[model samples]
Target: MSLRGKRLFSVNCTLGLACLTLCCSVSPLFGQESSTSSSGRWLAPDALVTIAPAMEPGETFQGPVDLPLVLNNPDIAWDPHYAPKSDTLAEMGRDVVFRGEVYCLEFSFKPVRMIAVDIPSFTGVQRKNVWYLLYRVRYLGGDLRPQVEPDAFGNQVFATPQSVAAETISTPKRFFPVFRLQVKGIDREYPDEILPAAKRAIAARERVGQPLYDTVEIMKQSLPVTTAAGGHSLWGVATWVDVDPRTDFFAVLVQGLTNAQQLKMQGEQIEYLQKTLVLHFSRPGDTMDEMQDRIRYGIPALEDPQRQQYILDQFGVEKRLDHLWTYR
Candidate 1:
């Protein structure tokens, strides 16, 4: 008999025995069935084992009848999705598990890449790429509710279940065949050849310009008045200020260029001054306070009298000097 037939018989036998036990109060014969339930005690003719025809000492028996002792079918079939058709003849080397009710499966594969050489340039380029595919298949008719619950770490986790409500389902019902194919090398063309050409096209039409548009002569004429006493021109005072610099005032002057021309030129000068100050203070590993003190005494070349006066007014000379020592 077939494996399915045997299963059906076993199921029927179990049901019959259950019914007999239930009807035992009405029939006395039902009690006898319970007493003979142990193995080696025959409840039915097929359920009991019969010893084979005695083999002569050391004489072997091998035939169709002998095969029945070894032959046993587990009654399992390969999943249809990954299995090859009768015409295709491709064998699935990997093991796969399938649950007909839930219709979900997962597996792994290694990615492969193919490279090709361009005939004109003789340069190798990536041609094709393949990624490992793994999936879970689901039947459309079953419930597809999301199984989400908070985990111990206070994060939500999803569990795979056989069925869920229609409203809670998100994934589309589709057949997923999980597979790992050792795909042989195949050359497929890349799609980014036009990217470099596009970039070149944009670069050829770009424009560039400077910040302040005024002429250099206009900048010289707008120089601020010198605050030095006794016939000292602003240029002379600037020279003297640099010689014995007051660092704090220089920072204030640089900060006051909110509406000044020659902005780029002033920026370059400030950068140079900062670089020089850093080198001087860093030579012997001077402490932050000492470097700040040196900066506090350096004066700036200001080109606006009103801006200069504003700085002195907002922060008194002493306070401004203190700031130079502490300013970042």
Candidate 2:
């Protein structure tokens, strides 16, 4: 890869970590359908993210509030606003972790005083196929009721299920097979990437005299103020199943302008492209054994030579992954 490609990859890697990195706890992000209860989950659990309101803003921030992330899904507009709390994570989001997919996240947001909506129901739910889960979480929200309830933590456990499922890809006929190569179960440490990634993503674009608009910047600001006391992250690699199995999957940069800012490029220029958001959280350069698990960077190591070599050079690759993390 070229120099710019390397820099971009680093930024992508760091930001991916920032997006889903949360405090330590049980795999609240893990749950599956069994021979049990009520309805279907409108939103796939695999793609859910939880954020707590920042009661007190941090040093670099001013009144950061919690709001559902809005992606450009012509199918779904806004997600049901989800207010998260440290205790309620158990109920907020959990995935029926197949194979070894894992996620963690935290936000330095003060609780916003907004009207409360009752959490949606998945009382008795069934798991959707892989493709369905990918599409809904990747590009849609805001139709069905949310999956939520108060867990023992006194925190409201919830899932943002839309009131009505958008017809966009409602049926399988409308769905086309998306190529995916997911290689899970690997871990490593690259404390060096944090600061540089934040600065690089910020310098790329400054908004209103502030660069917080960038994802990495958002992470930089959020990490300190937010804490998942018992959180951990995972790392692994794979090219999309159909894509170059040799070349591993990489990061998601908004390409042109961030996808949300695409409104200005409407008409012929409006290309509603989709970028996957992977979240992982970990502290940089910390050596506390109390911290057993750590944030797993979502960047999957591809079997391709370029990708494996790039990761090896950029972040120290773990020995366990050395088997696939080899040259082409």
Candidate 3:
């Protein structure tokens, strides 16, 4: 769609976020007017995509939304041979499509990072220093199941209202997730490592008689992720939800909240959400000359071995990347 005459909707925002219409233009909406990089060039085949937020908008609790309130009693560690097995770099030079009534977002950066991994509590290969692009997810035409219910911990089950269990969810179907967990690259199905855990949990639930009646499938969903890729639109990337092997992430959220903050977030009106964007760039060290050199000469400046060493030597990787946060 041509964003020709549409004056961008502006609103109160902070950090890298700037408010824009929900169906915002794909143009670089929040960056400087300069069209080219310091080297005077634009990213090639740069794919602009929308990823559902980790949680809904609002500033009540910590983070986009606390993950612990969303996942399990126990978290699962990602497979050690996780990354390097796939391309975990910032996504660029690819095509992404999202169908059904959707919300569009654009960023003025190359290799836009898409991540959804919550460590210690939940795990599935993740990279260092990525910003989760928060967008609203919606399924076009299908049964919208309510993915929430009290868990063993007595807190909410999922982050967003109508979320789905990716492990058990069928593909070629559509869904907007609470948030899509960011990983290094396309995922491969691993063994059902959680079967033992689930069986034990189910037996315990049976003893309690409640049997975790509604969440059995979700628990079983701790199975492997499907390796399917390179297909039609929504099915490609927007199809799956992260598998919660033990719900460790969710457990943490429940324990971390102060009683007051917890009640208010689940019930009251908190800080306003103004459709904002969060920018997470690579560790600095790219001088204007370095950036210019790559753009002007078509050399892979950011990927150059020397620059890679410079970044590792400088910051050593984002221990706590503050740029991804809005408040906490």
Candidate with best lDDT: 3
TM-score of 3: 0.19
Reference-based TM-score of each model: 0.11, 0.17, 0.19
- Look at candidate 1 and tell me the lDDT of residue 107: 12
Q: Which scores higher on TM-score, 1 or 3?
A: 3
Q: Candidate 3 on 12-52: residue-level lDDT in tens?
A: 24322634443243443222222323333343433333332
* Candidate 3 off by > 4 Å: 1-52, 56-160, 163-291, 295-310, 313-328
Computed on alpha carbons, the lDDT of every model, listed in order, comes to 0.24, 0.25, 0.26
307 Cα displacement, candidate 1 (Å): 98
lDDT, ranked from best to worst: 3, 2, 1
lDDT string for model 1 (105-129, tens) is 1111111111122222247433221
Local distance difference test, candidate 2 = 0.25
Off by over 4 Å in 2: 1-162, 165-263, 266-268, 279-295, 298-328
